[model samples]
Target: MNLTSSIRSAFTPQGALRASINLGNPILACRDADGAARGVSVDLATRFAALLGVELELVVVDAAGKSVDVVVSEQADIGFFAIDPLRGEHIAFTAAYVLIEGCYLVRDDSSLRANEEVDAAAHRVVVGKGSAYDLYLTRTLQQARIVRSPTSPTVVDTFIEQGADVAAGVRQQLEADAHRIGGLRLLGERFMVIGQAMGTPKSRGEDAAAFLAQFIEEMKASGFVDEALARHGIEGASVAPAA
Candidate 1:
């Protein structure tokens, strides 16, 4: 064991190296001045790569249906998004990093301030078609009428433009332009906080899951997750270190 460890230590660089695959979210991902993608996925992935002694290459793709297709086809190594068990056949997921709460945005002047006030027929809820948010509404709020769009940002815009009464969106975009959401108000509390896990091609290997587990553990110890959140201007998160 010691000999094997010595060999690995000698072969590995003091810094991280490159993996067989690396990925980036084409649609939701934002880039910094250095042109590196920057978001929860970006930050976390970078840290994960660092932990594993590998360099993360942000694989860019066209902005359309499930950018994860690149990862699924083995064009990339990892996919940082909400995990779906149905897709488990093509990709293996790491332990979930955080709870993804699907939120609803409404006009502050509207009557949907609370979850109790959600009305299926009265309010038109804009959502991304075939998205996790859509699935949630379809399963949980069977009564709600949702206008399916292609993305969360567009859904929020639908409500802002008076095309819909409500919009389903992630926490970041909802809070990013908080004031410019066109007088919109966050309706109700979180509808659901689905655990989000990262995915890597099943054929690639098990290192994806191994590295993610260790990455999350390190982030928890170093408070990197909280710092990442604040760096993006996000607030009201329940992410204090767990004792």
Candidate 2:
């Protein structure tokens, strides 16, 4: 479907599509060895801009919460985010384009052997402030004490420094940390699977959101998203199903 002029204006009042790229979610967006923003989310946003026939201006932020704030405040026209009810209040989300596993990482010798064993009164879980995992765990974890790290990438370091029992974050991030540092192991089962999607501020209106949603569905149906993931060498992330 062609993008209506009005919908296009709503999405990009500044003539360029300002896309918020969250650097915190490595599987979605991250800096390369050369310090360039390169990841599945960046590639997807570039494709969306091309489809709109507009220039793509990436607004890079280090955390998911900041990414949402930029879009909601109209500092950016759109952003990539993990779908969560808390974020839904401020932004209109497309059907998820990727599914990222969320799991706990603990020291190799820790007694927690499975995902189900994470929530206990004695366990202290460290999560990035305002992250998808933090929001989900806050609402669901009844027994464990949750601590906030400064950012998602710092969760593992924070866990080790604070002596927290578990570090909760994107599984890919934890896996990389496990390989880089010694004595870290992820639980065999995933506690949550974050649905990553493109979003615009709710102020952008339903028609604009709907237009973007259709674009996302088309990309998924045509395997654009899957191809982008492979091209970026993203692993442990799968293309989300059609809406």
Among these predicted structures, which one has the highest TM-score?
A: 2
| TM-score on alpha carbons, each prediction | 0.72, 0.97
Model 1 spans with C-alpha error above 4 angstroms: 1-29, 33-35, 61-65, 116-119, 205-208, 238-243
Per-residue alpha-carbon lDDT of model 1 for 105-194, expressed as tens digits?
776777666875675666677776656677667666756677877665566665666567778767656765456645767765887775
Top-lDDT structure, candidate number: 2
lDDT of each: 0.58, 0.91
Candidate 2 segments exceeding 4 Å error? none
Clashing pairs in 2: none
lDDT of 2 by residue, 55-153 (tens): 999999999889988998999999999999989998999999999999999999899898778889999999999899999999999999999998999
Candidate 1 lDDT for residue 141: 72
Q: What is the lDDT of residue 118 in candidate 1?
A: 75
Residue 134, candidate 2: C-alpha displacement in angstroms? 0.4
